[model samples]
Target: MQKQWLKWFVVGMLVFVGASICSRSVHADDSLQRVKEKGVLTVATSPDYPPFEFQVNQHGHAKDVGMDIELAKQIARDLGVRLQVKNMDFNALLVAIQTGKADLAIGGINPTPARQQNADFSQIYYYGGESFLVNRADAGKLNRQSALKGLKVGTQTGTMQERLAKQKLKGTHVVTMDKATDLILALKTHKVDAVGVETPVAKAYVENDPELKDFKAAYQLNPKDTGSAVALPKGATTLQTAVNHSIQTAKTDHLFPKYLKTAGKYMQVNTANTSMWHYWKYFLAGLKETLLISVCAVLGGIGLGVILALMRLSSLKWLSWPALSYVEVVRGTPMMVQVLLVYFGLGVFINIPALPAGIIAVTLNSAAYVSEIIRGGINSVAKGQGEATRSLGLTKADALRFVILPQAFKNIWPALGNEFISVIKESSIVSIIGVTDLVYELNVVRADTYRGVAPIVVVMVIYFVLTFTLTRLLNYWEKKMKHT
Candidate 1:
């Protein structure tokens, strides 16, 4: 039985390693086969841009709805699988494709040289022109291309508009944001003098809100319609062919014009779920996800942290060196970089969903800091404590487990509580890769309400209340531990 179990373990490891190698080393016709086998097609999208892609209510649930969403669904149907949409920032979309996290990505993504280098492109599914989105006050003043010089103009990062704005409006500082909504906020706050967005999206925004009532397109930036296409991973020839066929079929069936009309109908606050109660649901869902991830990450961190701390304290060079190396690497990098690496870089091998990948990344990151916290707590114990344990004839392991750990934990409990609070805040980074935490859900609310600042300010208050309450509770717990 022991031999049989060992044989099975070896086989599983081999299969995992083989799959990882195949995903990284080759880009064959295997994409469609893999999707069929999994029974789901993962599509990455930035849903803040409407008509092409944006959030809408369907079956009492918020879902990506637009021309691209339907096209992605059509492709999934063609392949005989369920469709799963992963919403994130526009820049992260190509990274998702490169890392095999998504079968394909769609937004208002253009066929640019830099993007073409990283991924494959499908046939153009939609087209729109570029124009300036300015504050109502500045609408008349910044009417021409020459008017933008020396002023700050905002666009979504890594987008064709940024490059175009740079070329056409020489001397203008082109500030970039991750999403269109963020750019809206930046423009609203007067961070930039003007923003260049696709003509339809800009018009939709100005028409939706009274604050933007005076806001209008200063002038058309580009005369020709810029084409939007579906993006696939590099060398995904077969999948690209499949996606192109889906687009052609939709166009032939006259489905795109109907999709546009359907999407346009979703552009108002008079719809269901626009009430305050519905917005609260978004906040509550986000809060639930944030707390859940933080608790799981902190628990895992404590377990692994204790082991790592022990290793670092060990006299053996082998154990201490590796633990030290891991701590340094994790602590040296920013939290967002770690999340990206774990979600995309490590995703090259195994198929990791966003939630588990987020937990694992958070766990690994938290353990590094937790290890140092624990080690400091342990060191604060007198040297005589270990000596006294040994004098009692207890084994070193038993002494550490029974005598040392209990006391060390008592000393470190307050720090552990603070770490929990820190994790709660840090978990916001997980939303970048589409984990749908508090920040991600709030973003959804902003999209639904078109009241960006209110949702952000409200969630900021929610986070502050949570951490403040947790801190007060920890202070009380620490005081009680001392009395005991």
Candidate 2:
């Protein structure tokens, strides 16, 4: 058994490593051609920064707006392709390019030396100033870089500001978050004393809210590292050249300033009505996707779980060992990591969209736990039930199918219901991959409104309503099954 397990593990590892190498070697230089062939230029961005990239509620739908989005449009037009924008966490933007999930990433991305090692970049499009956002009360004290000693400072993860905070601040505690909205939330709640942000972003936040203020803080920066550029996969010289051409044209036409002006108009519209009711469409769209993923994942998980449970119960080692290994491995890993691996890692071989990838990952993860519940329920059935079915001359397959599975399902229905409920809640993690689930829309609403806690409270209430309603239905069903 041990040797069989070791053999399977080694084989799995070899296949993964071999696939990774093939994927990299196969797609390294075809980035530009792929977009032309597909007739669509896919761009990935994190839309939480106002002037650079953000979302706005337009006719009950969230639309990507801001200078980065406008620049993406110009690049797509320059390439003679339609533009497809994907929203995700900022840190995942470059990964999307590297994995072939996107043709390029443009979310106010700074082309620092360290970042250049991972991905290629186009010519700089815009140079943004650096500023810090602090509470109106502390604006007097934290007005300059020197006053930040012993203070807690927040910065967006995988950003130039994060590097600046760590490298420049001598004694301040640096806290990193995945979203700019989250960092602002932290700063507003006093979780952090100050937040490092782009000068325009800081000014935008201060203008939208009375309690926030922006101040310049001196930090030595390389001139080359201060401007925003589009990121492409390493070795994608063709695509890099094309994007640089777009940037150059935009600069020559002075389009960036116009893009910023357009973005400002959308920002005004976003802030004009901060009520949750005005943005109900965003939440509704998110709820629809969340329920779709959860329903599909639950149904898929149950079907696969039944197969895996039966395999583990089989007498043949060949059938049982692999099933056992899969369950163990899946149950041991985190769901967030699994979602990323499925979306980005599997993306190398085939281009799977974010929504389907999220569903598949959740289904696979749920199957492991669901199979265990089924196995336990099967084991708890009386031995006499199997004997009686056999004595009645039913075949092994029919006996298990007609008699065993029914009873096992009845016994495990409550557990299955609990798993389903858990899926609805945990499915929020898919937002990290840009699935536009409730959490994703929550962040968008927060960014659009510039009111951190309100959107959070609204999303929390929505999740409660969903889960609470699900719990009630589950309890009712469990009771009905018992009575029957």
Candidate 3:
């Protein structure tokens, strides 16, 4: 009878494992096959950006227009695939392409050395230079770069302007905002002394707004400082070649310049004199902040999750109930809502000043999910193991600690790893709450430099690196757990 039970148990386990693996494999194969069979190329972009990929009401149907959008449509048409534009955040556009979620990212990306490592690029589409926006009153006082010393200079967190401000103007306190709109607000509110941004955007702000008319471009950024190009996912040579040829054709047909003219209208500035290299440093600086947010959120979430999980599983009803409640509430609501509540609502209601609301919200949200994972793990252990310990005269608590929880943890580790991967992606939502995470950084870079696509590509590569590393680590742990 004992041999029969053991044989059946082993067979059941193998079946469960095989089913899980097969399901994942099938999903992967289907996605790839669909792309080949359909022959429709999906291009990801951020439609919110003007002159790049902003949305237009064409007979009440939302259509995207801008330099990059038009360029991508041309490429898709030439390739004989129905062109599909997938609207997403500027930062997420590149990730979509890199992860095979989209065929390409043609969202006004600037080609940089760092981005080139993970993605191929088309020839330069347009070029623009970085510049600084300062109050009209301060403009005359700060003509040279040295004038920014000791002032609070604000830039979109991950942009060429931020990097250049940090490197070129030393001893200045740099406050990194997430978007051009926020940076402009900061400048108007006197939250910062100056804003370093791209020339076209700076000119647009000054010319478009009556209030901003008081702000002027104190200096035009040097030409060796900007660039712009389309991004293809790493290993997508076919797509890259197609995109390059399309760009050359667009330029020859005057389509590229015409699109730029339309895009330039939104910014209230001409891009004819914009240099490609001027924005490079800003993109690199923003890239660093994006990486920082992802890493910090993961570490914070894991630590807080373990604690919440333990509390939820505790014998004490008071601890368990509240922990369980927290988990339920956080898991039940949208992450975006939680971020806004934590950053804007809680701060307003409690009058308690806190760190960036984004970090706190992500940590709290992670803990709740982690608790359920722990609860499931604890429940999965065989009841006999605990009963056997009690028969040996060991206390219930001692048995749980010494015999049951360890094995239970091993069983749930892979699930925990999957959760970690989710947390990495979900961290992007923190940007909506004004965190200069990867997504926010990309927006800043795009708005400031007008290199819409490159910054998104850079952020995407960073996310891929992070998630891929986590996956490898999870696999290693799974192997070790199985061995033990």
Candidate 4:
């Protein structure tokens, strides 16, 4: 009887283990578990495009106050989770979904064939018409695509309008901006001949801005390309199905128009009259990020720069040649190009946080210059110093460590300071990829307040102050070090 009982117990344990193994597959595949675990559904967006997604001052604070915000909130509410918005460049939104940085992406994103390859799309949540917005003075002459030949046109990067502009208006130079707000500024400043965008957004800018009176929507795009859908990470079918159901529910309830009407009220409210002190928070937040990236980049650049410098200075042709090539290539290109490549191109393959990626890109670009600076500094040191170190019975590594780097750094220190300052200025480019630097926040403030020039001037003053103060201090430090 005891032997029989033991056999049954063993059988029961095997059955339980098999069931557990089966259940593991279900939990591993369930993407919704994360939403429940975290209690927040993060949606990635670029909120500069008003009415769809934008910021507005709420009781002395900037809030995600737009149609998309409301729509996302509703979806979150339906899922019994809190809503969190991650603002970034529209071009980066799909990348956010693909890398699982954001659970969902909704920014009036039209489901395009190219984007579909990278991620899945929910059902269309909203439909909007595309139209040509041109300078009001030239509206009559440049209304048609044929007339736009040879003129520069602007569109938000990675958008359907960009593709359509390329296809329909072949001769037009399609200048891309990362945000709708920037495109509007480009159109206002005559940087672009016209901008092609969704009709409602074009209408919002024209109606909201007194200066935009000179811009007019020329004509509508084709009928077939108006659907805007939410994007989900690949293999997130369960979450995608839930989002599609929420969107369908919103459509059935006429939530789009209702959200737009409510968002319009907030969008038009002039927050310029509010205490400028209230908006200081945006700059403060930006300052923190700017410092973070600049400091981190400088430190990271120093480390990598040392490595590259040593490689370039090596006796071996193999080591020196590759390092030389890398420095030349990086130095030859613009920092902006490098940032885009790392964040967008390499991001497709690697998990890159916007902050770390920005830091990494800046460090890489800086490393090239830093390497050259360090190499120059090292060469400036006397050849006798190396001989002396070797005579002291030091290894090559110990010679570099004890006798070389200390003196090289002294010579390179001032140049490194200038590099740091240049980095602080160059850091502005990272804003395009959604780093919450001063530029990014100002972009938000400009759209939210519609007082575009003041926000820009303010940010410029802040940047100038930051750079100038750092320059003066660096100069003082150099002078004091000379005495030492």
Candidate 5:
């Protein structure tokens, strides 16, 4: 009878696992089919780019409408597909299509050779040049591109501007600020002598700000240079051709110019050139830092958590309550508040700087949660396991190490992975303290170019790629560990 029951239980578990796999496969297939059947192309873009794409909060949820966005929508309409704009960072749009997460990227993306390796590009939509923006005082002194040779120039990291600075203006000291906006601030505050940015961006800035009127564009660098195009994933040949036809139709109708005027009404000139790429970089950087912090915190927290968990599970009330209270206080408050308290608030009482304070804060917070996971895992181990170890002449510590911990860790592995991912997403908040991770970069880009949408879309793609990659790696490790 017992054997029959066990056999039935094993069969049921196999069926459940098979069902889950099938369900996931079906969902993925359905998502792809729905796009084709409904004739709706989901294009991800960062609407932060002015004259390109930016958010219009007409009702409540933000709607993206800009030159590139309208162009994309028109393209979709031509293809008989309803255009669904998924607002994101520039960098993210590429990754979205690459990862089979989105259909295409349509935000003034320059179809560089490097990008083309991973994605296909439609015919060029917009042609533009790159230039440098400097303070009025500096502009006069550095009138020529050659004059900027020795001066510190800021540019959005990973853009064609950065590439130009490295290749064409080798001697010029280049500071890679995360965003064009931040570059502007750096110039405004005398942090950098000038910023290498696109021509339209510089023109928009000088036109919008009276103070910036003094800051002239120091001769157009890389004139009539690059063109922007919509990017589709490498395997998406059908989608690419459709997008190309759409671009051709839109150009004939001069739809982009009309859309630009409509989008320009709501966008601030200061935040326009913020592209998706800028934001993607920031988010990826943030994800990396968050992962680093989470790993360090989890390791530190596990060590401390184990000790606290043991104490809480101890017979002595005195030992248990203090540890329990520490856990309560940490778990009670939001992680953001705790992060601020440690990084900023505690600066009054303690002189420890930002990075260390952040590490300590995250570690403490992680420890509280780790303690609960540990406690639950420990409790899940049958009492017999502990008794068996004790009966074999093992001390409490030995029993935990040899018997209890092994089982506990296995049970909590999935939960630990979840916590790690959560920490990664949460790390964006650290940018508030000037941590230059991901979001900080986005703010900088937004401030300078005023091409709002592209940079943010870029940042989102980077983060998604980073977090998704990490999650996969962790899952692989977990599976390997389980087998071991």
Candidate 6:
């Protein structure tokens, strides 16, 4: 009887494990059902590449309008779901899809074999060639690929063009930037001899700026290398099928030309008013987001910091050790890594939006530094004060609340204020994750207007004003505290 029972138990365990595997498989491939259930297909893209995906100011409101966005709409329509676009850095787009932040990524992605290992891709929707953008004065000399042999060539980071430039352009220095606009800026500033970009993108820049001109930068190409495709999560076969179908429909109906035409009109409108004042609404919106993230992060950091400080101060080994470790770990690493980890690492369990992720990361990062500042402030308080409270028959918690904390806060006030200022400045890093902080909007305005330095100057002035005003306010508070 015992042997028979053990045999049945083993069989039951095998069946349960098999069922679990099957369940996960279904979940992985249920991308289509997930979209329909939510009634929205979230598409991710880096909108800094024009004619492929870029933003335009429409009646004082910024809107995304490009061929890639149009294709996303087509896919969403075929899936019977509304389309929701999420703008992120180009490097973040594939990771966004892999982490379930979006249903698909359509930012003129090349469906290379290396990328295929990470995410499934749809049929190529658009075929494009490469070109090199150079100053018109040097166009005759640097027009061909061979001419770039010993010059600096700039490409957008994480792009096929970057890889090609590095691999194929022997004796040339290859520089990579996060945005196509930045690459153009580099070329114009003479930091790079030429900028490698998509043929259409190069044409768009050359048409707008007479100083720039493009010529073919040919390569020994594969079919996948020259075309753009939509990326989906790995094992999302159903979603890939639907997206491929949408691509086929667009191709059969000859809709690519129409998409490009629509994008060109928006681009023309965008360039019509390149003055910084014309895009005041964009700057205003960005300022609000920056303030919101900074204020929330600082406030939340203070609260968490107090708790951590208390934990570190505790006599209990477990509490104090963990608190110490957390502070050291957070302090030791770069904040950018923390931001990505919180945005994508924690995303494996929960889908946090970019704004909240930015806030959480900054809050957590600030807590560590704030905790150390608080701990130092607490230490600065006279030990005799604690003894005096104890002699008065006050409990430890009451002593901390009434005497120690108030004095500690008074001591740390200036440091805390400096932290607030630091957060306001450092918070610009959140732009990489698509939070519309002032810096993010600065890049958007740069791309849309194609006037990089002007937008940068405007953002720089705004940041200076903000930090200077904050410094004056902090000085005022410090004086008030001293009097108190």
- Which candidate wins on TM-score? 2
Candidate 5: which stretches are off by over 4 Å?
A: 1-34, 57-61, 213-225, 268-426, 429-484
Candidates 4 and 5 compared by lDDT, better number: 4
Report the poorest 10 consecutive residues by lDDT, candidate 1: 216-225
lDDT ranking, best first: 2, 6, 1, 4, 5, 3
Candidate 4 per-residue lDDT, tens place, 174-222, comes to 9997777778778878998888888778788777765553333344444
Single out the weakest 10-residue window by summed lDDT for candidate 6: 17-26
lDDT tens digits, residue span 8-74, model 3: 6546745764454334323322432354468887777765445566543323223466777778778
- Write one digit per residue (lDDT tens) for candidate 2, span 453-474: 9988888998899989998998
Off by over 4 Å in 6: 1-28
**True-structure lDDT of candidate 5:** 0.66
lDDT of each: 0.80, 0.90, 0.64, 0.80, 0.66, 0.88
Better of 2 and 6 by lDDT: 2
TM-score of each: 0.90, 0.96, 0.50, 0.81, 0.54, 0.93
Output the lDDT of residue 96, model 2.
92
**Per-residue lDDT for 167 in model 3?**
72
Order the numbered candidates by TM-score, best leading. Answer: 2, 6, 1, 4, 5, 3
Give the higher-TM-score candidate: 2 or 4: 2
Off by over 4 Å in 2: 1-23, 26-28
Model 5 C-alpha lDDT per residue in residues 1-484, reported as the tens digit of each score: 4345545654674576445433432432243344678787878766545556655433222355667777876776666778777544454567556544457787667777788877778888777566677777666676667777788888776677777777777687889964455667678778888787666666656765544522333343432235778887665556666667777777788876677566555555334433444344444555566666667776888898898898889888777776776786777778867765565344433545445666778788888888899999999999999889988999988998989999988888889788777666666665544454566556545543444455667677777877798789889988987898
Residue 107 of model 2 has an lDDT of 91
Misplaced by over 4 Å in model 3 are 1-39, 47-49, 55-63, 213-225, 264-484
